[model samples]
Target chain A: MDKQEEQFVKAYAPATVANVCCGFDVLGFALDAPGDEVWARKKETPGILISAVTGVEGLSADPTLNVIGVVAQKMLTDLNLEHGLELQLHKGMPVGSGLGSSAASSAAAAFAVNALLGNPFTTQELVVYAMEGERLASGSAHADNVAPSLLGGFVLVRGYDPLDVIPLGVPLDLYASVLYPQIELKTSLSRSILKQEIPLKKGIKQWGNLAGLMAGLLMKDYGLIRRSLHDEIFEPERSVLIPLFKQVKDAALKAGALGCGISGSGPSIFALSPSAEVAHDIKNAMEKVYAGSGIETKSYVSKVPEQGVRLVEQSIYQTV
Target chain B: MDKQEEQFVKAYAPATVANVCCGFDVLGFALDAPGDEVWARKKETPGILISAVTGVEGLSADPTLNVIGVVAQKMLTDLNLEHGLELQLHKGMPVGSGLGSSAASSAAAAFAVNALLGNPFTTQELVVYAMEGERLASGSAHADNVAPSLLGGFVLVRGYDPLDVIPLGVPLDLYASVLYPQIELKTSLSRSILKQEIPLKKGIKQWGNLAGLMAGLLMKDYGLIRRSLHDEIFEPERSVLIPLFKQVKDAALKAGALGCGISGSGPSIFALSPSAEVAHDIKNAMEKVYAGSGIETKSYVSKVPEQGVRLVEQSIYQTV
Candidate 1:
């Protein structure tokens, strides 16, 4: 461990949505605004250490299950860099709320560690590392959330072979209203319930929408994105688990959201709008829907944070 | 019908493949070196009239069953064009051979009539008209083949709402080897045999390929297009109808073809190559594969024709 260093590091990892309804395990983008923050300090020690943790409750009996712990260890191992670290993870977002809580933690850890190592990895490379941590939490190495969390904008995974990621333009006038109902749907269980096979016709529709969605992102055409946001395969079954899913979605649309749909594997829903004015109305509508169903919900009205994970503050200490 | 006219005006139609394998229906291009030619001339009569027919045998059974005849009538009705004319269609490409014979016929007739009427419509407008003709043949409205036929070049249907069609850069060095076995697979029947459902995992794979394919076309990257021309949904099931399908595909790959697969439907296959040398080798390999299987076949080696359908040559009809 480098005992002489004394700089505190803080970072942010934004929210993301996977699948986009029709493009399950394939398509995703960074939500405009709202993210988790993490701060850490380097310490002198003989062995790797996560001396502290917060904003995390009942995470896992095994340290390996903790996203930050796992990601921190992997980054160290991948770089062959040894360091004892005192970590403070601000779990600013709810756990398992389908807003990429796990991804946020992994991203925050990756960002801090990359900075600690002198930022040796590129943003996409960090995403690849973060996805490894996410896989420990969800049992799949999906980059949809991690890519956006690290890149801080609309990220497209063109193909995996030599992974091509496209960062697209976004309309500045819009803010997304994201809501999390009290209803809980475990990410692992939600994914397990899905059918292994889907209709060929459904696949066709999904591709068309996905293509249109990519185009919409590139052009920053809000209407095109909204009209193209369809989830023909995964949402039908997953939505049943979220109480009043249709009510919330319909209400969001009525409230002037360009479009609305479940975020990740929900209990959470997100609505797209041109401004906070529209986002505020959508939020109220969503709250009303949740209220009608006798469920408490939490919501955030914000824009997509274009700056991905970064070091906010850092410090170092030595014990000889 | 044109008793007072010196020469009888006639029209022809071409065959087309709508989906074009990987793209389903949204994307398609034209095959121009060979196509059906439609002829149209003024007549004393005030409506369309049919005269001598070539290539297509026994198409006179019903005017509705004849895709060309139906499209011509629809165009006339839609535009409310009132003129005396006779139509003649020369079927050059074999039907159900996966060479887009239907689209060729439809586009030929539409172009001839429009030319005879002084070109009132743009290329895109003609594509929509040709699609109506394809509907008569395949029971679906698709514009891929029609668009390329009317407007020659590779195209991207960015979206259908505004009907955006962006032309892509064509790779000059790319050549194709097409082999048609003396067998038939009706497009409708081919459409029917497909499984209606597709798995989400596979959907991701398809989109990856789609993106790669688009990038390859845009960048004029032959290697990329070859590596990405994977048709996950249609090729496997349809390839069964082509003799020695596996062997032919293997030989083509071994002989320097980047990638090879079933073209349009069955009984025909195509390979992508970077040069004429590789293309000719693929042709010889395909012949070897089919000859051993006791199937008579014809082959054509050509580049992506930069031009679609046009009036190749016309003998001027003097006023009687």
Candidate 2:
């Protein structure tokens, strides 16, 4: 083994907001804070191992059961690297929070291991390996979350058959506010409630909004973004499951938010604003909706980050 | 009456290609040639009249039956102008060729009359008035054609309730080639064959492509535009109605066209290319498919113009 093999690399992957209102299953962006961290070390052995997991309870340490371990194993197998990997996952975000918790861990682990091996694959090339973790967690291999968590900025999952994930231009002044209710909403149950068939007229309107939102982001038109960030397909059906969804959305909009909608398959809600001050105000307004209602909530205000799955720390250690 | 009322104001409105593959009923762009012209004059009396109709047989000269007359009458009524108007309609493109023939007439009349009345409305304000002519012709008030024909460049009809028409950026090097097969396909028949409900999976894919195409246009990414110019919902059902649709599309792509699809309703195929030379090549290749098949065809190759309707000529004359 090389001298670099004895070093431990810790990487941080940002939490992502998938679906992004009008762009269901197609758009996502990374947040600046509240991300997962993974520490990776390569060994002379030939099997993947999860040394520990922290920051969240009830997570398994088994290499086959953990998301980070599974993603790292896939990367190693795909690259034909016979070296063993040891990982420690620190979850900074709650699971089932609609904040792409699993995607963050997978991206951090894959990025850390790639860094340890001198990055044989580009950051864009690591999206597929990270998607396997989403499939294990949500029973579907979707890149909306994984792509943004790995690539940062705004991402468009243009297609899935050939797996085309495109990184889009991000408006630098845009900010996001997320309010997560401390309740679990199963991704499968949320998905099952959606109608399999939609009216053609509604579908046309949805795509129009998608096109408008994409154009608004590219041109940095705030009014167009506010007008286009609406969901007519998935939000109506899924919002019934979220407590006080309408009230939260209304409060966010009243607090100077550009747009607001359910975050992923939610119990969580997200609102976008033009500035960090407005985003903080939106977060406060959203939190007020759940106040005195016996529901605990966690809120985050952040600027959309430009980088994802970055190496945070690295240290050399002596083997016992 | 004023001295300007005695002069003849002639305006030209360009033909448009609607649907634009993935963006059905929402996207369109203006072409440079094969447009209609309208000559308008205000008299001291208070009723609208169509003085002459030329360049196409079987068009009505009656104010109520002619599209230009109807559009001009509506505009006068809406603006509360109590002046008599005389219009001369000159059709430069074939009717029912899926080249937005009626939309051109409506836009030209609206634009000409607006100019004659001291330019009371902006170009964007004329789209709704132009869409009224579409309703009279096609039984549906769709602005996909008239919006682009009035606003120039590419337009997205984001919504219909309040009528939101947004103009998109067009690449300077983009060229379009259109081949209109001389066949009449009724708009109602073309619309009736479409299914009312579609699978949600197909809808997701369609929106993904729509977002990608909009991004491609705003960023001037030719490869992304080529990849995203696909129609999963409309073209499949509509292409079967057009003769040699598959053969023409295949030939265009093989001849270095970026994308090819049915224009407006049917019988007209449009291809976009990076340069005017490649667009001309695509036009030739598409024309060869129907050369010996006994189908008469009209082909046009032009760069996408930045201006739509404009005053082509003005002449002063005495009231006889």
Model 2 sits at an interface RMSD, in angstroms, of 0.8
Best by TM-score: 2
CAPRI accuracy category, model 1: acceptable
Candidate topping lDDT: 2
lDDT by residue (B1-320, candidate 2, tens digit) is 66666688999999999989998999999998899999998987898888989999999999888888888988889889888899999999999988899999999999998888878999899998888889888888899999989988899988886677889847557899999988778888899999999898888888888888887898788998898899998899998998899999999999999899999987799999999889999999999998998889999997888888899987765555
Off by over 4 Å in 2: A1-5, A316-320, B1-5, B316-320
lDDT by residue (tens digit), candidate 1, A221-320? 6876677677777788888999888988999999998777788888789887878789999999989877756787889887765766777666655347
DockQ of each: 0.38, 0.85
- Models 1 onward score TM values of 0.85, 0.97
Lowest lDDT 10-residue stretch of candidate 1 chain B: B8-17
- Docking quality tier of candidate 2? high
Q: Quote the lDDT for B232 in model 2.
A: 90
Query: Which residue pairs collide in model 2, if any?
Result: none
